[model samples]
Target chain A: MSDWAQLKQALISGDGEELCRRVRQTLDQGVSAKDILNQALIPAMDVVGERMENEDMFIPEVLMAAKAMSAAVEILKPLLAADDLSAAGKVVIGTVKGDLHDIGKNLVAMMMESAGFEVKDLGVDVAPETFVAAARDNGAQLVCLSALLTTTMPMMKETVAALESSGLRDKVKVMVGGAPVTRAFAASINADGYAPDAGSAAKLAKSLVQ
Target chain B: MKSKGRRGGIYRPLTQDQVETIHDAALTILERVGFTYESGLDDLLEMLEGSGARVDREKARIAFPRSLVEAQTAKAPNRVILYGRSEDSHLDLQDDLVHLGTGGAAIKIVDPENGTARPSTLKDVYDLARLVDKLDNIHFYLRPCIPTDIPEAAYDVNVFYACFKGTRKHVMAGVNNEKSFHDVLELAALLADGMDALKARPFFSIITSFAISPLKFCTQSTRIMREANRHGIPVALSCAPMAGSTSPITMAGTLAQIHAEQLAGITVCQLTQPGAPVLYGGIPGMANLKTMGYLGGAVECGMMNAAIHQMAAHVGVPNYNSAGLSDAKIPDAQAGWEKALTIVLAAMGGSNYVHHAAGMLESMLAVAYEQFVIDDEIIGMSCKVLEGIPVDADRLALEVIESVGPGGNFMTSPHTMAHLHDEYFEGNGITDRKSRPKWEKDGAADAWARARRLVERLLSGEETPYISESLDRQIRERFEILL
Candidate 1:
């Protein structure tokens, strides 16, 4: 099989070592890093995202694809510039303060990664300023905030306000979600959009940036 | 020892020793903790006191002697015939019958046309009942939503009117007050022809939550229970004690308190009207510690509900419990899994009346029309498990297998055609079984969307209100019917 087809096969089957080895082999055989990324890796993730939307791919399989994709990207990160890597946009995601729930946020981050977005995941119990700082520092175009508790929901508003005060609010569109978070609550907090679950969160993030 | 449809010994949660221990603990709690009451039972307390219960009139606590508790419990029939409007639809709440149905008075629905959450109106109640009417797996119809547009004084009658117009299946709902309760009875009497006719085949039952958590009885609920008994009606004393908040934290402790509350309800129900039907209503579930809110998706809640059914079987009374609910806001994967786990546990454990078995979402705060149709299919599949593997001569099909040996196909064989329908539950209805291409061509609808399509198709068809036009007119004229 051709090198491109072999790389696609390895990525689709979620073979991280094979994907990385194939990336190295393709580069050694005189393929450019940008060609390997755009021709093979990016299109593979687009298919995975479509399958997920079709309900043929599940969360575990999507996470596995994300891991394999990340493994392949680690090999190419040194060779390619930041602008040539991902066309799925850049996103900053974090769970709000006083909420120790990480599973929902982690799922969303992984899904966004597999859907071809560059993500900066500030882990659980994140401060308001941390989100603003990371979005500004990373030049992120999308910010996704999550809170699993009703008490921590107010902290979402504070995070959005921190973005506004730090002068990055208008630069990046904000999305809020969690178990207790509603579209009305997102609107009350002046968020750009709200999603009920992780898959929808990824789709909403894509739409916001687009 | 196994009853007709209840598959036991495999799914038993409480062993005999554990059941006896819980039983003894419940009787002890009944005699010691008793029940605290506020008002409206001033006279019944006196009467029960005269009849051997130790009643403290001032502080209002009624303790039952073990002998009286046992005797009053014995007066309750092991089985009661709860009739639907048509005689063919009657339910024998006997020996762990495992009837699955809808429950909860949720005040909202996901408006079918737009898929947005909104307060449930009278039209939702009527349409849901019509859907439940055609669903074969849903055995009975309980009031699933509260009509937010109706006034409180006329709530009970109007809701029951909508339910009565929706299906001929046995309908159950809680009344607002004593006056509304009597008015509901009057409407039933009109439909059934007379008071005597209504009593002869009482098409509906009453659910009076007489027992409050932590061993107390609400006086209004107690009065309604008494009135139901006076008219010889079946009543369920729903006592939901959220564990870690209302009852003990341990599952065993929660079971003991809930069973004690059930016995207290039976003691009152039977003492007032001996031989009246009373269900062992034990809705014991746990509260999420992180939020201090009740979680219907808790696995412990399912385990406790399954265990309570065993306890009710030991006490020789029909059981009532809640299952098939989700804490998720929408009809998504979380809702599907939560409903799947709880419904299987409770149904297999032989809960006689598993209410809230359909359409409940967002921790029992809302119901969706699509969810009702979707849950109907879920329940259809769950009830399929109750039909244990038949392993006699014909089911083994040794002869057919030998004839269709080695490379021979059985799809065209006589044996395959003989028992296929009986052995298999033909699957469809919002639970997809189509090919990927077909499903995509059919609008790529999720379960929620498929269910919405089903709701639209079902609601658009002919109306099948079972009530007669004259009686319907009389009910509307005599009372303030909102629909």
Candidate 2:
């Protein structure tokens, strides 16, 4: 099989160890790290993201693909410089404070990466300042905040305001989602967009960047 | 020395020893694998310390308190009557065919065809109210949470008012806090015109949860349960403990743990008021260890509901379990088989009330707006099964049978219409005997898609009964917010 096709097949099946080994082999064979990522990993993940959007892929499959992609990305992270990484737009994401839900945020982050974006996953229970700092430090063009609990949704709005306060609101468009988030809430919070699911979140992120 | 027939029919009451064994098994669950408490960690730890249970401070795991278990068990009620907004809506505790109506799926729909499944709008709430009003078998309505879009505080109040306006029957809703609880009570009081009226007719039941490990209660939820009980309002203590996680892997083990937790809540309610109305409601589902997911399939959920119903019957308290639900979306063969299996067993096993009778799909991860009609049909079929075989002479109707004779259609018989309500439940919208050409002419809408159109029809017009604009504003303004 061709090297790109082999890597694409490996990523789709979530062969994490194989993905890492293949990436290393491709790089050793004089293939650029950027080429391996753009040519093999990104396009493969885009297909996975599309499948998830069409309901052809469910939680477990998407999760596996994300894990495999993460393994492949880890191998390439050091080789690609900050400027080289911007081929995919930079996006910052986190689960708001007082809510420990990370699965939805993680899924969105995975899909975003698959759709060819560099993601700064801030992890769960992230304070507002933490998100603002992540966006600033990563030069992120888009901010995605998620909160699953009804009690913690206010934190998402607070994070958005913090971004605005830091004069980063216009520079970085903000989006929010979770079980409790609604398009009405997004409009109320003055968010750039709201996506109901992980796949939609990725699509919205791509659209925002463009 | 009894005959086989006599032995088969004999009532071998559960011995005190057998009850103690069950009690012991539950205590083991508490002592071994502690229950998960989201809030109230500090309070639960304190309670554990007071009850002489070993507490792991960091993890908040507590060893079981056997003495406390005995004390709580002593206070649990064997039976109680649940009241509605009117005395006429009361559900009597007995072994009979009782069809507690259905509630839609609580989860958000990710991909809807026409209308968006954004956080539930007022339109969704109003539509649900009207649908509940139309379903005859539904004795009570459960205000399923529109979790995604609306503010939880406003969501609670909106659902309570909707249910109150739509039906004179009872409801199960979650109040936001003490203030919301007070406001709902005040509204109920107004509808009845005072505390006396409220006592005579309890419109809604607040759900309470018990601390699983040491068998204690959360301070706020317990407070609401106590207050509701003091005012003679019924409560449903939902102990949704996950097996292999919160309780035990074994079904029997999980049930005993659930029983102990429910008894703890019941004991507290009775402590506040001796004859406090309460429903023994819990969904102690066993986890599929391989998948680490709760199997919401027919066999597992059906058995769980049946077991709980059996235990509740032992106490003579009405059961408010869930039924007419399926793991499938769209009315496929699996949906049909599972829905039929769930409702039939739950109804025949004598569950006094079952919620989730319609519009739930994907293991309750989403509510299919269109599936509600199909679910209603399933509820009707299950209720029909519970009617049992009518052997009476009037039902036999020898003369009517003679006129119909062998191989004759009952459609033209005069006796058919007379016993129609008794013989069969008339299906709503879904069941049809139309020929292909006629059916094709009318637009062949699938059950799910048809339910969607039905929901739109219900939502289009008609204000809820007796809910004046002034009263609604009064109820909306009433709030008790903490933090």
Candidate 3:
């Protein structure tokens, strides 16, 4: 098989070490970093996403593939142009203040990154101001808020208001999610979109940016 | 409501020979592997050494002989009655008599209004107890949530006080230490008018989680267990060994290990005070190897717990095992099926005190108010399964069939009218059976929404404290009743 095909198979099989070695080898063979990322990594991740949506791939396998894809991307990062990165979108994500849950938020971040979005994860217990500052600094097109507690859901609303008050709300699409967050809750809080889980969150983010 | 303690050994997950083999394996484990204790439990070590156990002082491990284990297992009471303040709420745990109740020390509760979790507080404890009081199918009220809002020193008393104030059902909770155990007992005595009367019925019980998994005893809990047994207070010797992490991964292996741990605990309790009331508390769970977390709702967990009931029965003691748990974070379809599958198996296998059967969600990390209401219906249905088809002459309805011969309608028959409520399991309004149009007219509420409405109605209806005015005043006077 060709070098790109070998790299793609390594990523789909979730062999991070093998994928990174192949990325280095393909680069040595005069393959452009951007070509490797676009032709091999992104397509492989797209296949992984489709498999996940089809229920052929579960969370663990998807996560492994995401890890392998990221590892290969890390090896190609220095050679690729800045504009070549984040070809999908720039996004900021976090668990709202007073909510220390981050597992769901982290999953969304990983899935988004694997889907080619540049995710700046402002970890758990993140304040509205921190989210606003991160969105402003990153020039993010989308902001995702997560809150596992009912008490901290108000923080999600406040973060949205902060973004609006910061005059960045019109520029950024705010998406909300968590265990307790519903579509009605998202609409009530004036969020631009809502997704029940991580995979759908990534899909919604892609569509929102479009 | 049907009676609580119905005979329920209909579904034996383990055969009689399997039970014997497991029992013999447990005996071998106790005789050979032994159990390790903390260094400071000098009294416990001395007692075990005096009672025919081989104690390696340097190792702080005590190995029981087969004869000692057999003798101590025989000493445990065949019957244990966890009495409620109201006489009708008593749970008679003996033979294959089955009772299901709430059990956990979860730190979070899903808010009833908005379907999200918050740190559980003292008020949540009282409120859940009150909810359990009104739930007919939940036979007892084990403290379901921790009062995180209270100070550590005040936790035990306040939790017991809240439960006592909220429900007259037989309340059980884990104590912090020997001091807290005495304080809770004193509080129960004040409610019972004296310590002697309180001891007689012991409306409340202690769940002494004395053993850490894998043949090790926690120091403080062991002390508390000894004190509880010495006072003739009913105690459940809780030893939960996570399969693949704490105990062996195989079901039979986990059973063998937990059985030995329980036998070790029983030996200790009997040696402390001969014939002390104790329940074989075997809460065996699987480990989510991905996260190394407790997998409470697996069918294997239910099967192992059901097998534990058989092991306890073999040793001639009532068992306190777990079922009706779910990994689902919400009261959705996953939660419903997981809870139902585990609970039915545990109840059918005749677990004497099946807990974690109500209100628990998120793998015992959280409880929801609506979930409790929903689980009440689930428990009601499981109990119906335990009731089984009484295949007698009356239930066979031979004469009634003859009377309603030739395709006659039984719906209009007097026999149908007589056995209407008695025969079938009348659910508690949570299950939706309405036609499509009628359901749409009623706003199409799902089980969660229906249960939430029931919760709101029950919580708002009235404020009837289980404790009387005088008793409340007396309890407040003596104790710092935070609830």
Candidate 4:
């Protein structure tokens, strides 16, 4: 098979090791790293994303495909031109303070990464100050906050408030989620967008950035 | 399922080993992961300690031994009866009985008058109950819409009163708080003629979400469940664990976590009042990973709840499960398909009380009058399916078949005349069974348009409600009677 076919085939199979190997071989063949990523790797996850939206794919499979994309992206990161490095916008994500849940947040981070965005997961029980600092440090264009508990849902408001107070609210789009978070709740907290799960979160991140 | 067409149903998606695997995992989860009690639940923590479960007081986490959970679970009743105002409407819930009904606290209603959506009021609640009373297939009334306009203090009484006055079919609602729970109990006593009488023949039951998802207890709802238990009122322990969000991503994993939560909630109820009549409610919703909506429309949702019914049956308790709630915003083809798919699964699986079977739309955010009528027709059709094919000499119709042998027409046969009404699917709403030319002659009405007409017809002055004029007046004089 052609090396490009090998890259696409590796992506579909979610073979992280093979995806990285294919990226390396393609680079060795004198192909541009940007072309390998944008043509083979990035578009591969987009297929996974579309399949998921179409219910043709599921969570574990998407996660596996994301793992493959991440493996290939790591190989292309150093060699890619700077413009291709920021091909997808940067996002800062975390579970809000007083909420320790991370599964959903981590899925969002992985989905964002797989969707070609640069993601910095701030981990669980993240305070408002930490979010503002991470967004500043990472130059993130989108901030994603998650909370599993209704009591901790209020912390999302505080985090959004922190951004406003830090004068960075205008510079970035904010998204809120968790089991208890609703579209009405997100709007009430002055959030830029709300997605029910990780795939939509990635879609929202892309829409917000564009 | 002693009814006419009870098939000894064996829809086993999970084998004995798989069920055991889930059961063992649940016990391990309780032992290791434990549950976090919401604040102000020190009494619950104390209860756990007394039961020999480990309690981390400061962190509000409690872990239980498998034996303690099993013993408490074993104390729950195997059979429960929910009475209608009239004796015929009563529900005798067992592992095999399937009761289809409507359930939601929908804040909005698509107005039947003008087909516009608006905030629901106490009258909407009362009217919906009246319509439920009229529908032959909708088995129970669970206050499909929330009376959002009522005052907080009087909401419980008024809501209960509206439902009671509208239909005698068993009404179920969750008390807003412990105090309102007592208030509604008092109102129930008045309707039953006394507190003891109400306890003796409780027509109403409480559906309480005593536990939060991922094995934690919500303090306030737990308190209400306690009050309902102590008062000898039957209750349903409803735990809605959203898959891929609150619970595990795998549907099987979600069921395991759900089984653990349901068992724990049942344990609490039994601990409070031994042999308390409680239904094990495991409404495992899907967090449609794409939308993050707590959806109950998928066929897998039907399978999960059916499996939940089986799990609760395993624990020897009547199961209260949800189905027929569509993610569709309107009563389109999507609504019909989603509702039918889920309700049939629950029914075939033998869930005792399968709710959200009517009127629920937009992922339980809103209800519609036309949708209720359409769902009533769906329920009628699905009930026929649940009545699995009967095998009897008479049903086999040897004589009739012999008489009509060799393609002789059964159209004029006596057996056809006798059995046709009961045997066939007699859909009432706009299912569009008519041919195109005839349908055009009859105005070419869609399901929505036909449903609206049925709603209007059912709400007409001809049908008398279960509540008597004199009794309603007496109750009104006693309570606020906001409606």
Candidate 5:
């Protein structure tokens, strides 16, 4: 098989080391960085995501494939142009203030990154100002807020207000999620979208940006 | 509600010969493979050693001989009555009598007010019990959620107190430790007027998950089981082994392994106190191979749980099995279908003491209040199915049918009026049966929305405690009552 096929196989199988090695091998075989990425890594993750949606693949496997995809992209970063790196648009994400839950937030971030968005994850207990500033600095088109506690759900509304006051609300879409946040709550907070889980979060983020 | 402890066993998934084969295989497993105990349970090991079991002290393994297993199994009472607070609510488990209720130690609940998943608190425990008390179709109240708001030391007493405060149904829960177990017994004694009175009725029972899967015993839960047995409290030996991860991959193999585990627990319980009231608790489910998560809503899980009822019957013990689980995040169509299929199968297969029959979602990780209301309707229908058509001379309505023969209407017949409430199963109004115009005029609410409204209506006007004020105050003085 071709070198790109080998790289795709390794990435889908979650063999990160073999994936990176095959990336180098494909580069040595006179392949352009853009061709290797668009032809192999991106398509491999698309398959992984589809498999996940179809229940053929699960969260751990999808995360492993996402990790491998990032590692392969890292090797091709220097060779590719700046705009080509984030072809799917940039995003700012965080777990809102007073909420120390980041496992769900991290999963959504990884899924979004694998979906080709450049995600700047502002970890747990992030203030609304931090979210606004990160969105502005990253020139992001989307911001995803997560809160796992009922008490901290107000921070999601605060983050939305901060984005509106910062004059970035019209420029970017605000999506809220976590265990306690609902679609009606998202609408009540005047956010753009809400997704129940990580897989749907990535899909919703893509649609919101579009 | 109309038919409590209805005779089921109409839908047998396994043949008599197949059940005997599984039983024989389980006996062989106990005789050869045996079980390993944790290091600190040497006293339990010594007890087993004295009861004609070969003990490998070096490996902490106690292998039961076939004769010892048979003798111990025979010592357990076949018909165990889990007494409710009132005589009317007692659950009689014998001869394929089925009782379905709630069970889980879920950490999260879909908040009833806002429809968001949140950490389940002590109030949720009490509130859910109140719901169970009002819903006639849900027969008993197993402690559904853990009180995440309390300290670990206060968990057992507070949870039991919250359950007792909310409902008069037979309450069952797992204790945190031996001290808490004793504390709860004292608290029950206080409520029942005396220790002898409490022991005589046993308004509460203990669920001891003594056996780990694949022939291993959990140390703390085993100690709790021994104490419960000695105290003459009914205990369920809960052994949940996932098909692929914990036990064998095939259904029969999983059943064999779980059966062996149950036999081991029964042997220990009978050895501790002869003729102890024990349940053959077998919660066997297949693993989601991709994620290795417990697949609680799988139809195969329903099949295995149904088959476990037959296995328990073969061993002459009332079983504590599971059904009515849904993996759906909300009370949607997926949740409805998954829960209905499994619950009906278990009920038809005659699973006594069926828990997780209501208020569970996301494979027992979380529960939705609306789901409980919805599942009550489903379980009522299952019990109706279990009641099965009673065809006799007068019930066949031969003369009445001949009188109303070809072109007559029996809508206003005396026979119709006499059998109206008894014959047909009128659901608890959660299900909609209206024209499009009528449904639209009523806001076109789905099952979830309707169930939500029902839940709101039930919990809104309730502040009555099940226990008396004097007893509550006395118990409060004696223990740290968080509720």
Candidate 6:
């Protein structure tokens, strides 16, 4: 089969070694890095994601598959940078202050990357101002805040307030998520958007950026 | 110390007398003021008549005997071990706290391409079973809902049977259906058949839920409960009321409504077969008035769970409640935060039983596999909290403290090793122990991926309790022909 098909299969089957080698080979062949990424790698992740949502594959399989895609992406990163192929959008994401959990934020970030967004992961225990500074520094169009605690949902509002106070609220949209955050909560906290999971977050990020 | 007004929005902390007062008030309403007739509760009146309760058949109002309620409440286990369907399935419910479980599938469908939101199947059942097996704090497994795979009519029974195969010790929340109930009993009898020779006991019991608020029972669930009672099986009269929908908006009002419903359930069970065991149970959720969405982990829901547990204790009945459920989606900070608060509060509040230990989100409309992993960790924390402060001489560790007191590290100390097993909390298995570098080296893992790995490991490595092949065939036949 063609090189693109080979790359796609590597992604679907979660073959890390082939993914890395093929990604580097594609780069050496002077294939446009963006096309290799958007057409081959991202779409492959999307397929795996779809299979996951459908239960055709469970989490371990999807995770292993994602790992392969990640390895391929790692190999393509410097080449894409050298080619000046910038991501579609920049976004900042993290679980808010006083919360140690990061899985949801990490998942959203992974899916966001797969969707072609350059995500600056702020990590857990990110203060409100930290989120604002990251959004400003990264020139991120969307600020995604996650909190898994009921007590800390109030902090989401604080983060929003901090953004609004910093005059960056108008330039950037804020998206709040986690188990306790509802669409109504997003609205209540004056957030730009809310998605329940990584898969939906990818779709939401795409919509917001566009 | 008597803080006035609402301390936690929907809930106001109450004294033991106040909680009992609420229960009494609800019982009086159930007996005298009566409740409205929903689609299925009309049968409750007939059932009451059959059970020798005074039912105003014309109005469908029933007067329950207080003595019967008290008696059935007494028969309920203050604390009982929920055995798995095999030698492996049993967790002792120490009268101090409730254990939580995740939902069985409510709806099933065809699998999707993405690893998330996929249509559930029997494989999903096996996946969840393994997840449940690794959860020491989960203590119980709610038949995780999977409606996409099975027909809607058979969803409950199918999920229950699937979970039955996954667990060996803890009680599986089997469906409360006439057919499924009988099928499960047959499976139980089969498992117990050879136990007489070995002096071992059977695994599994029946847990039937009821709709509380406008006090009554669903005809189908009631029939199942009646049959379960007749068979001398333990019953959990779970009354889940979405506040402002089935229950009044106020937490006190909601609590009273549930109490009356629970007492009515107790009365019905007793009248069915005097001395039938039934847990004073409820799984009430709060309603978000603005969105009309139900809230499961609201502070009010936790407080109500505590109050109900206290009420059950007062009547000398074991309690069942909703705990360890976070409204947050994904196992993130909000999920962790809410789960931690609720689990800690409920465990400390004298709850004898709890539900929703894992796999719930979006007001319980869905279950995230990763969240289950996080919840297990939260439950581990709660169990540690439940273990309370160890006060033994070794726990004091004066010598260890003095030996390591000045500047020495305790990491390699003999005392540290001696106490570490009992003193240190190893966390529920879901926690990521690797450092950031290691995590990055391993591809920046997430809870969903970890939980998936854990589930697979348990399914492949652990031997879940299973009935004999002959018994298994018999169960399949019964479900095929009878159900």
When summed lDDT is taken over every stretch of 10 residues in candidate 4 chain B, the lowest stretch is: B1-10
lDDT of 6 at B305: 76
Clashing residue pairs in candidate 1 are none
Candidate 4's residue-wise lDDT over B8-30, tens digit each?
A: 13565677788888888888898
Model 3 per-residue lDDT tens digits across residues A45-158 = 877766665556656677888999888888889998887879889999999999998877897898888888998999999999999999999999999999988679999999
> Judged by DockQ, which candidate is best?
5
Error of 1 at B205 (Å): 0.4
lDDT of 5 by residue, B74-109 (tens): 998999999999878999998789999999998899
TM-score (second chain) of model 2: 0.80
What interface RMSD does candidate 2 have?
6.9
lDDT of 2 at B379: 69
Alpha-carbon local distance difference test for all models: 0.84, 0.68, 0.89, 0.85, 0.89, 0.68
- What lDDT tens digits, residue by residue, belong to model 3 across residues B258-315? 9999999998999899999999998889876444457898988778888899999998
Q: Least lDDT summed over 10 consecutive residues: which range in candidate 1 chain B?
A: B1-10
TM-score of each candidate structure, all chains considered together = 0.70, 0.71, 0.73, 0.79, 0.75, 0.62
Better of 4 and 5 by lDDT: 5
Candidate 4 positional error at A155, Å? 8.3
Return whichever of 1 and 3 wins on DockQ. 3
Q: Model 5: what is its DockQ?
A: 0.25
Q: In terms of docking quality, how is candidate 3 classified?
A: incorrect
Provide the global lDDT of candidate 2 against the true structure.
0.68
Question: Which of the two, 5 or 6, has more lDDT?
Answer: 5
Model 5 chain B is weakest, by summed lDDT over 10 consecutive residues, at B286-295
**lDDT per residue as tens, model 4, A64-96:** 788888777778778877757667898899999
TM-score of chain A of 5: 0.90
TM-score of each candidate's B chain against the true B chain: 0.96, 0.80, 0.98, 0.96, 0.98, 0.85
Candidate closer to the true structure by lDDT (higher is better), 3 or 6 = 3
Candidate 4 backbone collisions, by pair: A196-B291, A196-B292
The segments of candidate 4 whose C-alpha lies over 4 angstroms from its true place after superposition are A1-13, A26-57, A71-210, B1-39, B54-63, B106-123, B147-158, B242-257, B284-295, B300-304, B327-329, B362-366, B384-438, B462-483
